[model samples]
Target: MKKLHLACLFLGTLILAAACKRDTDFNYYYYEPADFALLSQYLNLPDRPENYQSTLPKHLQSLGLAARPVDYDKATLGRVLFYDKNLSKDGTISCASCHKQELAFSDDKKVSAGVFGLTGDRNSIALGSVLSFSAYYGTDLFGPSGVPFFWDNRANTAAEQNLASMTNPNEMGMSHTDIVNAVQTQPYYEPLFRMAFGSNQVTQARVSEAIAEFVNGIGSYKSKFDSEAEKTLGYNTYSNLERNNFSGFSAAENRGKLIYLDNCASCHSPLQGRPEKMKANNGLDAATVDAGVGGVTNQANDMAQFKVPTLRNIELTGPYMHDGRFATLEEVVEHYSTGIQNHPNLSPELKYGYQPKKLNFSAQDKSDLVAFLKTLTDQELRTDKRYANPFK
Candidate 1:
């Protein structure tokens, strides 16, 4: 009897080992494109974006395009530039100082406290989904990518993205000359600068270029839904709650989707680009307020208009809004559901059949929407070695 029990135990162990082996085995060539038919009727884009006339709205169709390949050295230099403190006046703050990696590249403070411990007007936007801004690409003649970088769409490129932050007196507060001097004196940067720009001397332009590469690389597409959407990859540890959350919202959120399409799709893309373009201000407050893009242009019509950020990982990167006005996703939904203050320059899309300022979401409906948003979390990205801090 004892011998028989031992044999059974050994067989059970072998079976468990085999199961573990199957789960751990990875197949690389599993990914495939989504079916064209399903996306065509709802999202309304061509099967091949390269051949199709893009429906990206405004100048986005014209602006959005695939990024050209980058040099490995240049991209590496950009990573270094991102963490370097010489860019700031006091030589104390680096990009990572505010956009920490652990918090998914967002500062936890309601408003970013910068160089002199001065408070910023708005909360720091996370670095995720930043590189996905192809919709507003080529918007800037100088730094085409920078135009959409700031709270008010002020920066023109990722290279120029730090200009205001570094010199804002409240942020880095560093003068251009001071920054150049610091970089020039850094012994470790010489080879990196030389490799990136074919010279050891660091210049402002080189700094910008390197930083942009790193920022662009900060992008991601994998998430609970993204993986599930790709049947070839199969499923991993995603919970049933997350899946059920998506299905539950497939109805009500479908209504929200229609609402978003007629009203907000021109900017915050639900299905515009490869990953989906995002940007739009849904009349958050009364006119004459911050005036998001208008703040950059000083245009009256642009009042209260801010760039529509990605709903990707939207569940994580908040308090909410450029100003961090809403504390919870529910609050943001409620506000959009009802609280948009009427204004003269309000977005025309929000004019009729608008969701009231106090959206009347059922408890279940609100919970469902929140669950769908949580599926956007890319658990892998947070743990991936490529994007993780090298020091760790």
Candidate 2:
């Protein structure tokens, strides 16, 4: 009886030890309550400054362009919405799926995959420096300076753009009603919605607005180029020599800057006063299938026109162009140097009389051009925790 009692005690001790080990393993795999509390702070944000301007360097601001004020709560709400896969029909995709923060908020894929493994038609355009969109495109500020959104410029505002993506069958595949229901069902969204709109009610318009505020808050100006540009006189006052010999740039990069100014600046000027007409047919083909802006306007003259994206983070946001045809900067340089075709509505900037003019850049010039483009990369924007995924 004593031996039997001792045996029972030993078995009980082993069982208790095993239970404790299992509990420890479970705890190790899951996030702690403290970790969740810290993450929740991102979702339930504090009030933002009413007149919050972007963190972009002062020297980079265009003369007449004013920074739009940001509401912190709204933008924080946007950040959550941007990353939430629950917004999709199957809970498989989010805005971050295409516009990844690591790639300057652009996709590495030539075309991004949407919900259910469907691929988008065009390469995703990078969302870096989107804060400048309203200032550059708003009709009240810069008359006819920019179009709505997308490669074709179909949507009028960032909110409209977000809605288009969310509803598109190939993208998020959720309707207005469905989006409201989906968001409402998620427990985490109630707090976010309340913070953003002062109520926990989820509406389609409010969703888009929150997402747009978040997108519009993203800015990139801490690049090597901005650093160098700031050290010189203001963008408007810089002399040709000062502009070319920007501080910290190597001789090759400086030479390439001159080449860019001479050849590429009319359409893609680094300084302010962007072209009034934002879209251009960059002589991609003599005849093309994609009607671009013409598809929206149904104007024959607008055929083949596409929106001109800012060159702020061009180095990381490639393969270049609307269709993502050119995989490398060298390929892009080659296209401009020799591959320009004669399209009837080609921009005057790319034309010498009736023929599409070739840049005829030498091999060395092409290499230097690629080197200079790399200087535009903003390292801080790539790793900034504020824009990072808040969800564990």
Candidate 3:
């Protein structure tokens, strides 16, 4: 009996020593309740403001997250919330009320209409492929960390971006508290909220987090242009017959290709993840009507500048430009062909100009150009199960 007791004591001491020494070596960062509380209050949620870790993937972390992942269910809920009209002040608006999915997340209106039929100053933009890129704020407001969102790169993170739209009088025009209340009161949301956040309790921060998650999940890639480029650039997807068509494509597409490469590529650049990201002026108006980046910078040089949207899925995300100003690819091509508003900030690539010196289309050229542009669409993204509205 004494031997049994001594042996038990010996094993207990050994186990205690291993727990203290070995377990201490492995450091697993975890979220404290206080962080969620702060986020719920909108106190410090740039996702990585103050280097806050995002639960994003390692590749995403290389893009820069401290070390936390965005909540997936929360993001999915945010998608439904985004398209939901009840959160608006007048119930006439939802996030999609301005940013339509058919138009690649943009509205057809030149300026978005808001509560009381108030029209906004700028055009709506498409919303997808959010995770592939980094945030940008002109003055390094994120401190050489990352670029923020918006035309001027204003909002620092997806959470903040969601909050801005909710409160903006010209947008949803709803209070954050009201949005939280609307979400929390729903029986459907409570189960989803609990599953996503470990608590059924809903709040503004979780709402923003979910919206950001949905935004991050929207990835648009594998366009037709991308396919062709991939084949040519050695990505290796085309058959020999498709490759044989390459010469004809080059002969036919080269003119349009040059226009795109020289002019459009600078901003829409190949794939969103590439290092040298693109943004553009596309010469809509040399004196951009809305004062794009200028609003954020107060700098004359940055006036009328908007982030260059991905040409991927261009066929679907139309009524083009920052104002939904051009409804068709031809109109957009022509703008670059000759309609440039000739301002100081206009990119120099246009100075050399189009092959015909204008994008005036013969029926064939227009058809070919459109075909080439259509290749930018990724059917998979449009049909992605992840991006579908959960409310339905």
lDDT of 1: 0.57
- Ten-residue region with minimum lDDT total, candidate 3: 44-53
Q: Using TM-score as the measure, which candidate wins?
A: 2
TM-scores of all predicted structures? 0.69, 0.84, 0.69
Tens digit per residue, CA lDDT, model 3, 1-392:
99999999999999998778554466332334454443335222223212212232333233333323445556656666777777788888888777665555667677788877877666676674332322322223345345457766677777788788888888788788888887766545654566568897778888887777666555554555545554454423223222234443555564556445544555554333331343445567656687777778898877877766556567777677777778888887767656766766765555444321244455666666666667666676665545554343
C-alpha lDDT of candidate 2 relative to the true structure: 0.76
> lDDT tens string, model 1, 268-329?
55432332322345667665567677777888776666665666566667777888878888
277 Cα displacement, candidate 3 (Å)? 5.4
Candidate 3 deviant stretches above 4 angstroms: 1-70, 129-147, 231-255, 271-280, 352-367
lDDT of 2 by residue, 211-270 (tens): 888777777777887778767746454455435587689988998887877887778765
Instruction: Give the lDDT ranking, best first.
Output: 2, 3, 1
How far in Å is the alpha carbon of 256 misplaced in model 3?
A: 3.7
CA error at residue 189 for candidate 3, angstroms: 1.8
Leading candidate by lDDT = 2
